[model samples]
Target: MPAVVVVGGQWGDEGKGRIVDLLARKARVVARYSAGNNAGHTIVNELGEFKLHLVPAGIFYPEKTCVIGNGVAIDPEVLLGEISQLASREIDTSKLAVSERAQVVMPWHRLIDRLDEERRGANAIGTTGKGIGPCFTDKVARRGIRIVDLMEPEDLLARMRSVVDYQNAVITGVYGEKPIDFDACFAQYQEYGQRLRPFVQDTQALITEALRSGEHVLLEGAQGSLLDLDHGTYEYVTSSVPSSTAGGATLGVGIGPTDVQRAIGVFKSYCTRVGNGPLPTELFGEIGDRLRDHGKEFGRGEYGTTTGRPRRIGW
Candidate 1:
């Protein structure tokens, strides 16, 4: 049983997607253990170029099982859109599975993320504004709505009403923004649930069974070690842990440490940090510009896969 985990060694954009995509050919199951649409994986193969947000990059392989683990916070709209986009490209997405225990990213979460970033102003953490941070916040605060909850209309409606009440208060009182419409939100998410229900399952059991059957499983992570909440630069890091050695992958996949046979850390020839953060080795001036241009690190190029913003490259 070969259970491998591929994690980013430096700040994200370390070609983990490409590595995972290549390695996925040997894997029976390839699962994304954490993060959400806030993290993007751009893959180019015989099928052309694709920028995957929520779904695992392994979906390209019709024979492999691709999973979104419970550690992820899923935005149903983004997920469905990605599925449709893949379908348009003639990729079979029927093998994709989502963890029912995963938390949901509501429309209000996106609003709150934007408002929060705006409030932070110059000191903003440079979030992707995809509601990832807020969704994790709700998860930690014990007020999150999971994929399973969405399957139950009445339960989901009741929980959404209470959550919206609290979220509206914060939006209005703290952020000074208008309250989200409960009815519209419920109806929209209700439909999302219907669309997503077919994909939901107990992913822990799924992966466990795969491991027990001596199948090769790959656990993929987003972001990077330097962006880990606990170990990275304070206030300028991602909210989740992106370290495979730190048990993030195991936790995401609901497995024990012994289950993982090895952890492969991916790094570029040089270092790069996306968004805002302390880049001790960041190159500036003409050299940086030349490097950026040579690497196509700006505008619809390599760096454009996720944010399009120029990556702060270094040694």
Candidate 2:
């Protein structure tokens, strides 16, 4: 059982990406078990720069295979768009495989996400407004569309129409917004389905086979342990699990409590967090601004990949 699990110990923005990228050199596989594009992993090496959202950080090394696990809620359009960018940079993403069980993030997820923020008003959770929370909500409700659903045209359309009708009612009647157009939305999803079909797979089997071969597999977790839904700051945590313990469970690796290995946590020289959450160690003086400025923390520079919002820097 040569498995290495990399997880965040702090409130996120930890250097988990760099650690996973470093470990990817020796590992046969690198898997992202949870979280969406909200978290951004910045890997800076001689091979230019890479900020991975949905894709695993190990993509830079062609030798390592990357898996996107079922626990993740995927946005196919965003993922394909990002993959194209990687291709433009000459990165070989052919080794990437996504789980058929992964949930699809529809356009309404984004709309509902923003509406939820607006509803929060002054009590906002500082969301990226990327539809992550809403996506998770749909997933838990058992009403979400999965990657495999993309394969069947009639089924996909039927599901899409039903969901759009349901969502449009909420948008118009409850949220006082315009109704969502099923035809347009269905067409867009159809294109996404066509493009994403090739990457969808049974990642569990692929990863299990690799583990059985005595190969080293590293589980890269997005977000931080402190931001976990169950353990993180109340009402301010991400929808997914971010701890090492959860990483194993989410990845389906079954890494036990006594796996008898090393546990490493990464943190920056400073502290920073994005969105509305309880930050016990946040700095509010010139030092905070200095750290933010020195880090070039503004705009979409190092913004949350999942949220697309600029992160708050601290020291």
| Residue 11 miss distance in model 2 (angstroms) | 1.7
lDDT of 2 by residue, 93-145 (tens): 99998888888888888898899889989998876666778888888887899
* Stretch of 10 with least lDDT, candidate 1: 296-305
- Which residue pairs in model 1 clash with each other? none
lDDT of 2 at 65: 90
By summed lDDT, which 10 consecutive residues of candidate 2 come out lowest?
251-260
Compared with the true structure, all predictions reach lDDT values of: 0.86, 0.76
Best-performing candidate as measured by TM-score:
1
- What lDDT does candidate 1 reach at residue 153? 91
Number of the predicted model whose lDDT against the real structure is largest: 1
RMSD of 1: 1.7
